[model samples]
Target chain A: MIDRLTAFVDRLRQVGVPVSTSEVIDASTALSFISWSERSVFRSALAATLIKNGTHRPVFETLFDIYFPQMVGELQQEPDSEQPSSKNDAKPLDDMTSEVLEALLRMDLELLDRLAEEAIARYAGMMPGRPVGGRYYQWKVEQALDMNAITERLTQMLGGSGPGGETAGSVLTALLAREDATARMGELRRRIERIIRGRLISDRGPEAMARALSRPLPEEVEFLQATSEDLAEMKRTIAAMSRRLAARLAYKHHRTKRGRIDFRKTIRRSLETGGTPLEPKYRHRTNRPDLIVMCDVSGSVASFSRFALSLLYALSQHFRKIRSFAFVDAIDEVTHFFEQAEMEEAARRVRTEANVVWLDGHSDYGHAFSQFLQRYGDALSPKTTVLVLGDARSNFRDPLAERLHEIRDRVRKLYFLNPEPHRHWDTGDSIVSKYSPVCDGVFEVRNLRQLAQFIERIG
Target chain B: MFESPDRVTAALKKGGYLSDAEIATSVFVADSIGKPLLIEGPAGVGKTELAKCLAEALPARLIRLQCYEGLDESKALYEWNYRKQLLRIQADENKDWSKTEEDIFSEDYLLGRPLLDAIRSSDPVLLLIDEVDRLDLEAEALMLEVLSDWQVSIPEFGVIRAQRRPWVVLTSNATRELSEALKRRCVFLALEYPSIEREKEILMTKVPDMPEALAERVAEVVRAVRNLELKKSPSIAESIDWARSLIALGRDSLEDGEIAETLGVLLKHSVDIDKARGALTAK
Candidate 1:
C-alpha cells in the first residue's frame, strides 16, 4: 500500500503537481486512518493531504483516477485478460476490419468513421480487461483496422487516378499533396486514440472526466478560443497566480534596503550604548508606481482585456493608483466602474456600458489614441506605467503611432500586450510593427503563459 | 488521540459541531502525525470555527494568535518584559552589572506569547493561528522555525521544546499566497460552503427554535445569494443569524419586507445588499 501511494505521488509530480515529501508522508498516514472501502472518503483524504493549491486539485484528481482505477469500480478484471487471444493472434484481419481498411483506401472519411467506431467497439469489448501502462485497446483496434495497408493502397490509387477521377479522388490527392500519407495516417491514429480515451473516461467516471477534460495546462490554452467554462478555470488559475505575485511583492517590500544613513537615528541609538554607535538606521524608499491601463475592448480582444484587468485588479494593492480605459474606435475612461463595483462586475460593465464601441463597431486605434491624448493625457507622468492591451488592428485606418509614442514619452515605462501571435503581426491591419518601436516592450501574449511572463517582468 | 476519522467525526458531532469526513480525516491525520493543518477558504466559511470546535473535541486548552500586517516574533513567539527587567535592575543596582543583566534576561523576565505559551503548556493545546495570510513574509518566516521544530530559541535561555506538541491549525482567507515553505509542513484542507441539504441540517442544529420551513427558506436564500456575484456571500454564521433574527421577529416564514429590512445581517456591503435586494425581489 505504501509503494502504491508513493507511486501515485510520483505520477502526480510527473503531471506538474508539486507534492512534497512531507505531503506524501501525510498522505500515507492519512490513508491508514480512512476506510479504503469508501472511495469518496479515501479520495478526499488523499486530496486533503496532497493538494495545497486548489488549482492543482484537477491534476491530482486525474492522477488519482488513473492510478486507483479500482476505487471507481472499473477495470477489475484479471491481469491475464489483457493478453491477446491465441485464436485471434493466429488469424489475419477479419472481414469487418477489412471493410474499414477499404473505406480508408477510398478516402471515404464518412464511411471510415462509421466503420472505425464499430471496429473499436468490437475490439474493445473483446478485451478481457483494461490494459495497464499504455492504451491497449486503442493500439489493438488500430492494428486490427490495418490503416497502413489502406494508406499504401490509397497512395497507389491516387497516383493513377489523375486530377479528374472523382471528387473523392481529387480530395485524396489534395490532402496527400498538403501532407504526406504517413502524416495523414498519424492524424487518423490520433483521432482513434481520442475516441478510445473518451470511452475509457466515460467508463471510469464522469467526475474524473470533467476534471480531465478541462485540465489543459494554463499556459497552453489560447484565450481567443477558450469557452466560458475554460475562461472560468483560467480565471481561477490567474487568481492563484496573482496571489503568488502579490506575496512575492510583499516579501520584496518588507526587505528594507540600506539607503542613506539617518544620522539622527544613529545618534539616538548611541545613547543606549553610552555614546557608542552600535546600530544605524537607513532611509528606505517605497516605489509605488501609478498605473494607467488602456485596453482594447472590441470583439477581437475582449477576453484578453478581461483577463488582464482581472489580474491587475488582484494586484491592485502594489500600485499607488490604477486608472483604466477601454476603447474600440472611441475611448472611454472606465476607472470609475472599477472603483464602484467588484472586479468581475466592473470588467463586465466596462465591456457593455463603456462607449468603447463606435458607430461602425470597428477598431480605430488612431481615433481612440487621439481622444485619450485629448482627454486624459495630463494624467500621465514620469512615475506612471502605461499598459496598452490590444491586437493593434486598426482596420486600415491611421494608427496614430505618434500619439502612442507621445504617451510612451510621458510615462516611466510603456508596455504593449498584443494578443495575436507574433507571426500575425504586421499582417492585415495590425500595426504592431509601427507601434513596437515606441513602447518599452511589445509582448506577444497569445496565451496566459506569455501574459504571466509579461506581468512578472513588470511586477 | 482520535482513533480514526469516524471517531473524530463522532467526537466533533458530540461537541455540537457537524464536520464532514474530509475535515475529520484532516483533523485525525494532523493529530496522529503531529503536523499543522492549513485550512484555507473564503471568509465566513467556518475555517476559524473548526479550530474552536477541535479544541472542544480534544478537550484541550485553546491558544489563538490572530495574525495581521506587521506581526513579528515579539508579539507571536515571545517578548522580554522590559519594565519588570528595569525594576529588577534598579533593585539589584548593588550587584554586578553583568550578573544582574543575565538574571533579568532569564525565563522569569520573558513574556510568553501565544506560540511560546502553547509550547510551554503542560496540558494539551490547540493553537489556532487565524488569518495567517495577512502576516508579512518576515513574520511568516519566523513561524517556520518554531512550527517545524515545535520549539523556540531564546538567546538568554536555551531552546524551549514543547512538553506536549500542540495540534496546530492555520486558517487563511487567501488574501495572499502563503510561502511554499510554510505550506509544505502542513496538511491542507479547503472548506467551501456546504450543500443546501447539509446547510439545512446545520441551520436546524444551530437554530432549533426556527421552523423547518423557515430553515429551508433561509438556506435557499443563502444559496441563491451565494450564486450571485456579491462582494461577500453570506456565510453559515450569517445564515444562522438571519434565521434567528426571523424567529425573534415572530415570523414563521420569509416576507419580502422582513428580508429587505434584515438583509444587513447577511450582506455586509451596500452594493451586495442592493444586488441581493434585486435578486430577492425578482424571486
Candidate 2:
C-alpha cells in the first residue's frame, strides 16, 4: 500500500504536482501511524500528508482515492510479493489493463490504483522527474480510471465487459479516456505548429509576443506545477481561452475622435449650458469590427485552432456584432460557441458544424478561399476583416493568388496569422509568401504575447 | 518599457529590441483608441509598471492586485466582513436571523481588490492584475468571467459592475498560457529582455548614480551571460545587482579578471556562476 502510495506521488509529479521527497516522507510517516485494519483512517492519513497545497489538494485527493481504493482482499491480490517489470514490458497498456482487470476480479483497491497508473502511463508515456501541465492531464485520466475501476468492479459483479457490449461510442470514449495518445500528440504537434507558423507569417511587430507574456511573479504555472496534471484543468484552460478569444473584441472600449466632432453631444451640452460649453462630451460610438477567422484546422494545427478560435471568440465578444468560424479542409461558423457556458460542447460541435465536403482534406488555401468567395462572398464587403489563421501548407498545391487578390478587394483587411517559423515559410508545400501580397496584414503568432498583440492591433 | 510607447517602438526600429515583429504590434496596440490594454508577459519585463507608467503619463491612479499562492474572490474581488457582521449581530441579537443574514452579506461589507476597487473608484484607475499567472485555473477562469462582462458575481452581494470601464493591464509569465477566455477580454502585449542599448539607457535613467561606462559594461555582460543555456538565466535583478556591486566595490570598469571571481553579486547559484564564467571565457 505504501509502495502504491509512493508510485502515485511520482505519477502526480509527472502530471505537474510538486510531490517532494519531504512530502513523500510526511506521507510515509503518516501512513505508518494509520491502522491498516481501518481503510478510511489509512486514506485520510495519506491525504493529510501528500495533499498539502490548496490548489493541489483536490487532484491529490482524487489521485490518492483512485490509487488507494478500498477492496475485498488487499494482500491476496498480488501473487509472490515481487513487483511487475513495468519498464521492460512493451505492452504496458495491455499489461496494465489486464492486471487492473485481474485486480478488479479480485476486488483490491490499492493494487488496482498501481495498475491504473500503469495503464495511464502506458499511453501517456513516462513523465520527467519534474512535473508539468501534460502530467496534470494524465492525472485527470488517473482520477477517471479510478472511478472506472470501481464501476467495472460493480459491472463484473453484475456480469459484463467495459461499459456495455456495443463497443461503438463507448469504445471511442473509452479509448479517448484511456491514454489519449492521439489527442496528447495532437496537442504537442499543434503547439509546435503554432510556434512554427507564428514565425513564418508577416511580422505583427517587435515586442508583440513579449507584452503578451511578461509578468511580475509566477501565477498559473505555480498553481499548475503544484497541482500536477488535471485533465479537467487542461480541458478547462483550453476551453476558457477558447471562450474568451471567440467573443473577444478588437477594442475593449473605444472613444474615437478621428477627424470628426461630437456634433450632437456638443450641441446638446451647449444648449443645456445656455450656449456656454459647460461640458463637451465627445460622441463616441464604440465600433466592434466584425471578423471572419478561418483556420486550417488540420491535424497539425488542430490544437492551435482550439486556442486561436477561443481567443478569436473572446475578441468577438467585444464587438457589437461579430462572427467566427473554423475549417480543416472545409469551413464552418462556430461563433455561437463564444459564451462561457457550453465550451466543451462547443469543441464537440466543431466536428459536426464543419461541413467536411472538401475535394482534398489537406491544406488548400485556394479551395478554402474560393469556397469563402463562392459561398459567402456577398457578405465579404469592406466593412469586414477577413482573418485567415493557418500554416498555409497547401502541400505543394497551386498557390492560387487570384482568390486572395479577390479577398483583398472585398474585405477591408486580409490578415493571415501563421504558426510556422520564417525559414519554412516558402518550404514544405507551404504557400504563405504567395498569399502575403494580398493580405493587408500578416503575423506570426507563437505564444500568448504574439496572440495578444495580434488581437490588440486588429480592432 | 523604453520610457513610453513611442520610445519603445523607436528602440525596436533601431534594433535595440531584437524582436522586430512585436514592435509593430505594440504601436498598433498603443495607437488603438478606447481599448483596455491587456499586457501579459514573463516576469521582470514590466507588466504592472507599464500601467504605472501609463498612470504617470495619463495621470491615473494605478490600482493593483498583487496575486498570491491562494488568492480567491474575497482577496481578489470582494468579500463581506463577518467580523463586523458578528458585532452587528451581538448588538442586534433579538433581530430576525434570516433577514440579518441577507442584510449582512450586502454592499456595506463588501471589500475590494484592484478589480473592484478600480471599478468603484470615481477617478480613472489603471487596473493591474499583477502576476496573473500565479492565479489558479479557477482564478484565471474567475478573472475571465469578470473581464467578459466587466461585472463580478457575488452570491451574497449583487453583481458589481464597472461604472466606468477602467484601464486594465494583466501580467503573466508564460509559466502557463492563460485561458483564451482571459486572453480575449483585453488587448495583449508580451515583454522580453530589453536590448543592450535600451537596458543601458534604462539603467542610466533609473540609476543615475551609476557611472555611464559601468552601465554600458553591465548591460553587455548581463545580455551576453543571459544568452547562455544555463540552469537559470541571468535576470534584470542580476543586472541591477551586478551594477550596484561594481559601484559598491569602487570599481571603475567591469574587467574579465574580477568578474569570474565574485559572481555571487550577480548570479544566485554556483552552477550559474560556472556557466557565466564559461560563457565569458568562450566569448
> Which numbered prediction scores highest in lDDT against the true structure?
1
Per-residue alpha-carbon lDDT of candidate 1 for residues A245-267, written as tens digits (9 for 90 to 100)? 44433333433546788899888
- Per-model TM-score versus the true fold: 0.71, 0.37
Q: Deviation in angstroms for A4 in model 2? A: 60
Docking class of 2: incorrect
**Steric clash pairs (candidate 1):** none
List model 2 lDDT by residue over B1-283, tens digit each: 2233345445443432333234333423332323344555434665555556655545468888886545767678776665576677777799899888887787786777667888788887777777776565666776765565677777766677878766676666544445555554444454557777777876666564888887976786676666543334666656777777777778877666667766787777665677567555433
**Residue A450 of model 1, lDDT score:** 74
lDDT of 2 by residue, A70-187 (tens): 3414422332222345445546344555565566555465575455444443443433232333334455455534545544444433233445544333221233222222223333
Name the runs in model 2 displaced over 4 angstroms. A1-459, B1-36, B96-102, B209-211
DockQ of all predictions against the true structure, Cα-based: 0.22, 0.01
Alpha-carbon runs more than 4 Å astray in model 1 = A70-214, A217-225, A236-292, A298-302, A306-323, A335-354, A357-367, A378-387, A391-459, B255-258
